[model samples]
Structures are given as structure tokens and as C-alpha cells.
Target: MEIRLFQLLVPGVALLFIAAVAVRYLKGKINLSEFLLSLIFWMGLGVFAIFPDNISVFVAKLFGIKDNVNAVLFLSIGVIVYLLFKLYAEIKENRRKLTLLTRKIALKDAEELDEL
Candidate 1:
């Protein structure tokens, strides 16, 4: 087994970085800052996954497993990831509609309401 310098930078740290972005995404916090962070997090994590080290190990631990657990962990993580995106999309769509409806009502313009 050969340990490389790049391995140290990736693995657990990188995946944790990805999880933070994903968490922010799931929370409907998709601003420019969030998007940029998510992009960087995923890109770095993706690049890191290529090496295979602590990330796989950390994921494996989720299943109360010791080895060869990447398959299960990966699937579970994928489902959660899919659900997170779906949630984000639904929330974003709702916010868009709310903004449009609120604009129509002119809640901020008290004079407009007086005419109704």
C-alpha cells in the first residue's frame, strides 16, 4: 500500500466539505455564494474520490461496517442526495411563486390596498 501526498488533502476532509455544501443546498440557501461553494466543494470531492481513501472509509462507517461497505453507503448517500436536490427544487419553485403572488398583491404599497 502506497500513501501519496494528495491523499492527505482529499478523503475525509473533501467529503466533509461536500456534505457542508449539500447541507446548505438542502436548506434552500442557494445564493451566489452557496452555488460557488457547492461547485468548489463537489469538484474537489469528485477529484478526491478518484484516489479512494478516508472518504470510502468514512462512508463505510455509516453502515456499522468495517470493509467493502462502499456499495451500501454509496447507494444510501445517493438517495439522500437525490432527495436533497428534490427538496431544494421544490422550495425554490415555491419561493418563486410566492414572490410573484406577493408582487401582485402589492403588500408593500398600503395605498394600493385601500383601493380594493
Candidate 2:
């Protein structure tokens, strides 16, 4: 229960991840939603990792879970599912846009050929 190393390590890693996300967002590589999601995730992770006992016990009790570890696991699974869904949506949108762009380019090329 007393993970001393993680007490320091987790927050450090979380901060690094947050910084990376911020940098990407500022560079215009990622959108606002993506930035916010990543920021919230890392901040939550850092908070939970830093104060596992305090928060975990409350969450476990709230869910009627006997074990704090189980509560943490449940929340982690939920977060993973949410992120996966978001990723799927982004991929689907990108695919749709790419298909539309390809069709447009092909039509333009065909029109040019017909003119020639």
C-alpha cells in the first residue's frame, strides 16, 4: 500500500505527460478537446497516484466496493474505454475526410483529362 517510489515517480511522469500534451496543443498538432482530455487524464492520474489511500477509500466506499484496488481498477477501465471511444471517433472522422478528399481529387483529374 505504501509505494514510496510511486509517490514521487507517478507525479513526475504525469507532469511530463501534461507538458507533452501542452506542447503538442500549442504547436497546433492537437485540438482543444484532445488537449483538455489529456490534461484532465494526467492531472487525475497524478492526484490519484499521489494520494491513493485518501481518494481510493472514498471511491471504493461510494461504489460499495470492498477493496480500494478494485475501485481503482474499475475507474481505470472506464477511462480506458472512454479514451478508446474517442480515438475511434477521431479515426473514423479522418477516414471520412480522406475519402471525400480522394474523390474530389480524382474528379478534378478526370475533368482535366476530359478537357485535354
Q: Note the clash tally of each candidate.
A: 0, 0
Which prediction has the highest TM-score against the true structure? 2
Tens digits of per-residue lDDT, candidate 1, 7-110, equal: 66566676777777777777887676766756675675656455466555655676666674555467568868976997899999999999999987785576
Tens digits of lDDT, candidate 2, 1-116: 66798889999999999999999999999999989988998999899888989898999999999999999899889988998998899899999999999999999999989953
In angstroms, how far off is 28's CA in candidate 1?
18
TM-score of each: 0.37, 0.84
For candidate 1, report its TM-score: 0.37
lDDT of each: 0.69, 0.92
Residue-level error in angstroms, candidate 2, position 59: 1.0
* Prediction 2 global C-alpha lDDT: 0.92
**CA lDDT for candidate 1:** 0.69
Candidate 2 local Cα displacement, residue 13, angstroms: 1.1
